[model samples]
Target: MTKTNNIEKAYDFGASEFNRKMKRITQERLKRGLPVSLDIPNDATPEELEELKAFDAWTRDGQPVED
Candidate 1:
């Protein structure tokens, strides 16, 4: 007896979620700037820590790490 199942309703919900995500991404892009490239140390992670142990960068010395 229920008639709540409808394609239009499903599409409306999906579109609403998509719009919300789009807005959030746009805001972050503006804050961080677009086309950003990250150059991290080879030992950035636990796995990479060993590989990059010998490698050193003058810029990273005593500087806080940013992911």
Candidate 2:
């Protein structure tokens, strides 16, 4: 008998699509001058912060994060 790791399987299927949707929503909020709240932990890394800053700049300039 084999056991399935449902959570891992779900993540594998949806992670990329979920990230894309979230990025789009974030950019739209930035364009509208609305707050963008993330679930980042307090111990987030510097790289994460830098990426977020870059995304903010791109969205402010009417650019999408993925492009």
Local distance difference test, each candidate: 0.36, 0.53
Q: Per-residue lDDT tens digits of candidate 2, residues 1-67?
A: 1114542211221135665666688778877889977556688787666555554444345544453
Q: In model 2, which regions exceed 4 Å deviation? A: 1-15, 42-67
| Candidate 1 vs. true structure, TM-score | 0.29
lDDT of 1 at 21: 49
Best by lDDT: 2
TM-score of each: 0.29, 0.42
